[model samples]
Target: MKMQKTNKWILIYGVIAALLIALHYVLQLSVFEVWNEYVPFLEKLSMSLFLIALIFMVSKIIRKLINTRAHLEGDRYNLLRITRLLAIVSSLIVATSFLFQNLYAAVVSFGLISLIIGFALQAPITSFIAWIYLIFRRPYLVGDRIQINGLRGDVVEINYLDTTMLECSGDYLVNDRRSGRIIRFPNSLILKEEVINYSGPDFPFIWNETPIQVAYTSDLEFVEECLLAATNRDFREHYRHFAAHEWEEWEPAVYFRINTYAWMEAVISYPVEPRDTTGRRNRILRYALALLNEAPDKVQFPEGTLR
Candidate 1:
């Protein structure tokens, strides 16, 4: 239904455009003979408007097609940005040609004006260039959680000169929870700083580890089993269905090593979604502690520093 409406509007635009062109030529040859100087300018302006309308209409259709298909969200967004840039460039070219009668004069005038503006807006121009790089390279996209130069957040918007992020782990919080703060940073920073994108090709999960310090006298096998049980209990569903694949076999792995405090450090490494890391770790610890307490002889937690 929406596509039909779009097609109808496109047809209407085509008819009106054809009529406008026909009327423009008719007026130039007959009705506007006395105003010859202004007639050509008027005709060119009308043609330029029609061309811009066509460009935008075609761009809209292409954007619609991309959005409806199975393309990735990042690809769709980058394509939209590229389409908009192309439309703006095309419109400017058409308008410049229509407004300037001499091609040489237009080039000279544009060069001089651009030189002046470029010098004046150097920083902003660099940021805009960075924005273009972002559109093409896709270091990150909206909804992706990222950390750059100590600011960690979910990207909310990417403007022409700046990117806005909804800050996470700010001020009072240590977890990956949003802090109700918005961070607006210049896009040019992408050129200078390393951007860590938490959600990417290995998206929906990242490796996280929980370290448990236990007495050396405890049964190492029983401690490792308890840790494994805790993680499996928390993330069994994720491991069984969404995470496991032929290319990547996702599951919890346990390792043990001796520590300086005369305690055995048992680490349970597993895959966890970025947002759920802190919560998942907390739950695993709670369950593991309960299980360890039930079997005091088998698993004993470290009490103090090394003597």
Candidate 2:
């Protein structure tokens, strides 16, 4: 429905542009001498409007075609931004041409103006260049969770000069949950700092571990079995895609480590999506504890001060 409405508006703009161009020729019979001065304005207006509408129509068609392929969804956002920038540039060109009688003179004047503005807005110009870099290099996409500088968030918008993110695990939260805070940083920051994209490269899931403490008297074999069982069950129930232990080193592992206290730590490590880390840890801990508690004599846990 939104696409249809946008197409309708584009059609209206095209029709009005055509009528305006036709009216320029019809104005020769307006009989009013004052109307002669408005002919040039109408001509430029019609041309600019027609060009903008045409660009939008082509972009819309391209996006509609892209919508058929699920993999190209990320590219659609980049294309939309480029189309908007193109429209703004085309309108400026038309407006400037109408302002000067000689096209060369207009070009020279705009060049000088741009040079001055470039000097005045060095940071913003660098950010715009970085935006172009982002379109091609794609260190992170719109929906990818990334960490750059000191900010960690999910990319929501990448504008010409700045990128906006929905912050996660901010000052208010200890877990890997969204903090409902908006973070905006200059696009140029990517050039100066490293960007860590959770969704990119080869591995789709990050390695996370949850550790449980057990007394020295606990049955080490039983504890390992219980942890592995809990991990396998969680994988089968929640992440069936990883049920097979054939995907490189993504399979779950149970390892023992001596803690600073008298109790030993049995840690279960598994691969999980970045967004599901907290929940996955919780589920694995709950399941592992349940299985261990069923046989308290076999798997002893620390009590009192040692716990």
Candidate 3:
């Protein structure tokens, strides 16, 4: 199978070489004598085609070499190494072109190429710049949960122009969780749109609120104490490291108050690890309920009469 694939590629390469040679001859007959001056535009044209083919061949060879090394040893950083190789190859190509071509010819070729590519890829260039910024700034890493332009998800991959995500909310999934659907978003949006990185440098913990309603006669003070006790006992350890790393302090508190309708409202505000915010909140709720279950009768709803 591999041999057949190799044969097919060889045939394709031969056909491409033949076509480039024909195009070169046709270009040789151009009315513009400048096209035939200096380097013979035909040779230049064929060289350009040959250079493109060489780049692809080199890329394939590098990939194969990486795979072979990975098989021999257990090197798992092949993708990063391959990307570096590509960058180096691109730089070498640019340097060689500038070195060999006459200054005037080089300038004309570069100017025309830049103008055409710039016009064709303005947005893509912007996105690529944004990707570079994200990579260097370390705003968010792969697997981090983030929200951008109102779309929330766990980042799956970061490509040249866009970052891919596994969508994590709305009708897409049960309990408003990650739906397993992949969404690709332009990196330029990171610069243009507001990005909320749940696990960023300073924001590694999510402020989670779990509100509970109780009867008017319920003791607000007792409820507050119980809630605080439950939170400190169950979640303090789980979120302590996150708080220390992100907030540089720890102060977990729960507040209780009586609303206008005389209902006791206990709002528990606690620190939760950014990655597991939802799960931690649910666990806190379970623990709070278990604590309240000790006084089930006292946890009754506020009294009211229907009109």
Candidate 4:
């Protein structure tokens, strides 16, 4: 559906450009030569239209070719953004051409104007430079969950001046799910602040721990076995995507921690994707509690308010 609409719009723009160019010549045929005053305007308009249409058509082709491949979504998004920047630049050059009679004059004039504007708009220009840095440095990419400064979210778009994210665990929510809020921060922030990208290529999973309070008299071995079994079941059932990666590196582990409430904390550390942290922890807890309840002497839960 989207491709069809794009093709239709491209055809429409092409027809408009063809008519504008032909009209530019048709009026100079001596019969309608009285309209020669409009010739220059028509010529510039036609050239701009043709160039924009051509650029968009080529960009569409390139994006379509790349969109078919899997696991290269970030690369495809970067290329799309680059092509759009190219279109803007090429259009500006075309518009500048007719404003001056010669190439040297246009270049010099635009260079001087850009120098003045660059000084006046230092913040925006710095942000644009930061955007360029993001393209190369890639601290985070589209679909990656990242936290910068105090803001935590999933990256959705990286524009020339700002980076947009879908915020997670906002003021009202306690879990890691998105809070239906949009966050737009200046790209320049990347240069000034540290970014925590949950997407790790080397580990392929975010190491997360969920703590459960149990009486110190509880069977330590049984508690560990139950927690590991619960986490392992969840991993085997829902997170099999990590199977091709390092298997031993992501194995679930249980650690005991002393609590001030006179109870022991069983912390189960496991590997999980960022988005699935909450749900995976919930499932593991449910399974672990069910298994532990079958053997009451093995595990004991806190009955008072310290839960």
- Candidate 4, residues 232-279: lDDT per residue as tens digits? 888889977765566886788999999988698999999889999899
- lDDT by residue for model 3 over 1-307, one digit each (tens)? 6445645665576667668767666666656456556447456657667655555545545554555555412122325444555756564564456455654665677678779999899999899888778767766667678888888888877777889888887565545377778889998998888887886655546777788888767766777877788777665557555434444454567777766666767899877766676786777778877878788666665666610
lDDT of 2 by residue, 66-162 (tens): 4445364457678778867876776676667667855687788899999999999999999999999999998988888899998998889999999
Q: Name the runs in model 2 displaced over 4 angstroms.
A: 25-45, 66-73, 240-246
Which is the winner by TM-score between candidate 1 and candidate 3? Answer: 1
Estimate the lDDT of model 2.
0.82
Query: Which portions of model 3 show Cα errors greater than 4 Å?
Result: 1-111, 173-176, 236-248, 258-262, 296-300, 303-307
**In candidate 1, what are the lDDT values of residues 113-148, reduced to their tens digit?**
889999999999999999989987889988789999
Kindly give the stretch of ten consecutive residues in candidate 1 with the minimal lDDT sum.
238-247
TM-score of 3: 0.63
Query: How does candidate 2 fare on TM-score?
Result: 0.88
- The lDDT of each candidate is 0.81, 0.82, 0.68, 0.83
